[model samples]
Target: MSLEVPRPIDPSLHPLVTGNYRLATPAIEALYELVTRCLRYRIPGALIYGPPRIGKTRAIEYVRLLLARQHPRMSSYHAQCEHKPRHAEGPFFANLLEAVGDHAPHAGTSAAKRSRLLLRIREAAARSGSGTVLLFCDESQRYNENEYEWLRDVHDALDRQQIKLFTFLVGQQELLAQKTALQVAGKTQIVARLMVEELAFYGIRNAEDVATCLNGYDQTAYPEGSHWSFTRFYIPQAFDAGYRLVADSGTLWQAFEAAHHKASLPGSLEIPMIRIVKDVSDKSPF
Candidate 1:
């Protein structure tokens, strides 16, 4: 017996496959508003804290795109913090350099790397019409006290150049604990500069929230000019038959509630986007 060759699938058409898509959600929109307010006031930075797997990182990614579209000329950079047994200045600056698109991140001493990073940021700010630059530090709960101080140094240096630097520190709830720790330790300087503002990112809280996300899949097209949204691309026949992911919102929400009760999980039923995405992509009834 002979089997027909399996058809090729485009990764871009499948978010589950490529993991390169962001949905428009109320939480993300709220986060964008908070960031814009900070930029408007030249606030040093804000802390975006939330529970794990609730899409804070995804919100950051989406908000960065929004920043580019809305500001047009402002420069933005993203650096991911890592869990360090001990803080090392060299690698920390290297991470910043790499995030800012430096060609030789490892080619200099700690001070030299910092100098280059500042130069690049200054150049970026100069190129911008607004003289502003934004930095997003993900996984920032791993950052130690010294890291925050070094960040303050960068903020001060940029201020001297008459350029505004706004940082968005995105991490899990430990970030709040860190902030309180700083405040308790009389590190008012760090708290005032970096943690003045805070935002709590949340997940789907109700059926309406589920519908909003489902609507995104219904409207978002894949492959840059195709009419096929992620939902349609995966189930063309059902899509043509007037089937939409949004129509499944009630069922999806009910499933989440049932599972929460089954597991005896505490707290209100807040469903993480990661879990919803997994369920829709992997086990949707359609």
Candidate 2:
């Protein structure tokens, strides 16, 4: 049998077919509100936990961009916790220092490194002409009791220095379990500080939520002064030329429903955002 060549993608439809798009789902809106409240009230720290592959990371990224635009002078730092054999405090503080553009020392005790990190954070805040520092820690479920205590120490230090530091701990559902375990183990202070509010991210529940997601892409503007509506690109000949169309067409809704059914959990009737997008992308070629 002869090998078949793949057809080249049309230039006009490139943007819509590729790249991740941000939709203002209810979870994302809740995240925005959480951040807004934290910044407005100068809250010390908060935790955001959700299931895996449900757009938690994407929501964090969107929040980062939103904060950068809204508070240009605020300093933002992000650290991804790793599951390694080494002590968690070392890598955690090192990553924090690196995120703020400071070099972590190669030869120092953990306490020394942490002290240096505190100093660096102060310097970064001064350089940025603002005392507000936002720290986003992803994969926080890997942290143990000691790691939680370390974070509390950092938060306390920032508070004593009069710096407004807000830490957002983003992780999977186990994050709550871990916090509960800490509380049960008599680590109430850590639980009190980090568990101010746990924002849980649930997937799309109804057709209106799906419509909101599709409408986001539909309203998005392309470089050619046109919208990226699915009805315009996918219908009327999947590969043929057409004008922009509204999202009211039942075609896109049916695709979303099918994808949701396929991706929903056995007992949990929830559909992850990633699965829906993947289903849409897979069907775009038709």
Candidate 3:
């Protein structure tokens, strides 16, 4: 008997198919723990460094979303660092101010702008009903020594006002190398303060993590109570069209293993989250 290939489903109708699904993988759990530690212990800053395409930015966004749902009172700001030689702090703080809904004109010298930005951040945090503020900076490897020093100054200033400001620097491995260079060059204060906690993303490894990731799609349901699993869509579609790929055998688990293998890197069993998402979305007929 010939099996008919199932027609591809429209991506706009499903979260999993549209690449909008967020799986609570081990890396996400570790990120959550690091953020929780910083908030609980009143830590000033932390570092999350890893290779590119390893879901660092997505994990940060997930944490921010989770915080917004779990703790509505907490305020969070995200800024992307610019790639320029000797990047200054004005644009950085300007991004922060904009994230916090402040439209005040940033006019004055560097010192004056810094003072105004800090005051605006404090006021925004006060209005958020929680004295805790989280500032996440991506592409942090582009920051220069002067920018790091400015961050240290802001951390100190915010502390003096009794606002718990936690800054999370997310970047590649180069960030750690630059920080070490700074520490050796007698700029140990900011480096030391930010080293309170460190978290690294190594991608999803082991069978357990793969199963967890697969289960995320399998258990999730749409508005009509249909599952996100491939078996629930692909196999049924083929069967409904009077074709059967396997007769009551373990095809779902087989398909999962095959996809995992395809997603894994050469000479390594670990599969990055991005790769897994791409492989799954590409293979799903629905």
Best by lDDT: 1
Q: Which portions of model 1 show Cα errors greater than 4 Å?
A: 1-16, 235-243, 283-286
lDDT of 3 by residue, 9-123 (tens): 5535666656665776789889888998888887778888998878888888889988898878888888877787546666766655665666663556667777787887888
Question: Model 1 misses residue 54 by how many Å?
Answer: 2.1
lDDT of 3: 0.72
Off by over 4 Å in 3: 1-11, 104-109, 221-267
**Top TM-score prediction, candidate number:** 1
Candidate order, TM-score descending = 1, 2, 3
Report the C-alpha lDDT of model 2 over 190-223, residue by residue, as the tens digit.
8777767678877776666777666665665444
- In terms of TM-score, how similar is model 2 to the real structure? 0.79
Better of 2 and 3 by TM-score: 2
lDDT of each: 0.84, 0.72, 0.72
Cα error, candidate 2, residue 189 (Å): 1.9
Q: Give me the runs in candidate 2 sitting further than 4 Å from their true place.
A: 1-21, 86-88, 104-107, 222-265, 282-286
Alpha-carbon TM-score of each model against the true structure: 0.87, 0.79, 0.77
